[model samples]
Target: MRYVKWTFYTLIALTVFAFLHYVLPQHDIVRITNTDTRRIDFGENSIFWASPDAGTGAAQATRDVKFIETIQQNGRPMVYRNEDTGWIWPPYFKFNSYNLQTEASDLRSTSADPRWVVVTHYGWRNEFFTIFPNAVAVRLAEGPNERIIPWTNIVILTLLAVAGIMLRRMWRQFRERTLDPLFGTAEEVWEDAGDRAGAARRGARTSWGRFKAWLRSLGS
Candidate 1:
């Protein structure tokens, strides 16, 4: 019985650990916008340089000129251009254009941009690359989705509920085994105690008799 109790406690501890490792970290649901344009495009000379005569020069020209113009108009393009890579934008680029005041409040409230954007520049030889906008390269706490209860979370919680039920059943069984004799009209424990007491008394008498015999023999 003691071993069983220990085993159950150990299992409970393991379950708690698993819950912490897998479940706790997943408490908040991550709702990503699933933006369509978030992708890495690569190819041979896909990056075209603007003509030297063009405004902003060849260095400033980008294949995604239209997209950049749209972003610039909004004053929050969240668009990144790399000389090596064409155009890069977070999945949230479209959200910036939405008229928040006119759209459904829920949509406006829920929209968000990705927390971070990374731009990598690869050399023509593909041997070396650099990231641009070095001064403000990193953005934190800007992901597009809010946390929602994930399915894994639901499954873990269900398992925990089942475990709780099993624990309750075990407790009932344990109480029946330990407390029935004391409070459930069962005389088995009292009877066993009385039998043990009688045996102890007999053992004491036998010991006394043996001690007397030993003393008499010593005197003789």
Candidate 2:
């Protein structure tokens, strides 16, 4: 009975835990949607342009311009955009500021007059800083679904529930075994022993008196 009680309680506790784990989102993947530019105060007197992307906006702008020249290079999508002006890949823009900077520096070193080198690098850098943060925010805002539950977590929870039930049963069985010897049939056994002890005392008293009489007779 004790074991049963514990087992029931353990099962209840484990069931609650399992329910919570199942209901709560653990792993989530968010899709990027739209990109927007914003002006932010970065302390001091310096002002910078930042671009952020929207994850769930339907009215995002779509540009049909080919940024990458080769659509398929080694069967993989290659970036082919205008060499002079970098394009935004809405919702999933690549951080091409570093690449732009390298390209601008090379152009300056090779050419007699550096044209739009600095301007191109600055543009790419500004977009990279802004859009990356926005995309991250959108990803964070998205929630996880039930299908994302890990198999290991499920198995662990199931085992915990089973162990709780088993432990409760074992405890109950142990309690019953301990109580059966002392309370189940031991009452009758104790009563019989008490009666026998009384009879033994009465017989001893009578035998003592008979022995005294026999000794007095021999003396006379």
Which candidate's lDDT is highest? Answer: 2
* Candidate 2 lDDT over residue span 1-220, tens digit each: 9999999989998998666543322332322111122233333312222232223223223322212111111233222122222134222243443353344234332123212211111112133343111111111221223234456557866888899899999988887988766675788788888889889999999999999999999999
* Candidate lDDT (C-alpha), each: 0.37, 0.38
Off by over 4 Å in 1: 1-15, 23-145, 174-220
Alpha-carbon TM-score of each model against the true structure: 0.26, 0.25
TM-score, cand. 1? 0.26
RMSD of 1: 17.7
Candidate 1 lDDT for residue 130? 20
lDDT, candidate 1, at 118: 22
lDDT of 1 by residue, 120-146 (tens): 111122223321120111122234243
Mark the regions of model 2 whose C-alpha exceeds 4 Å error after superposition. 1-25, 31-146, 185-220
lDDT, residue 195, candidate 2: 89
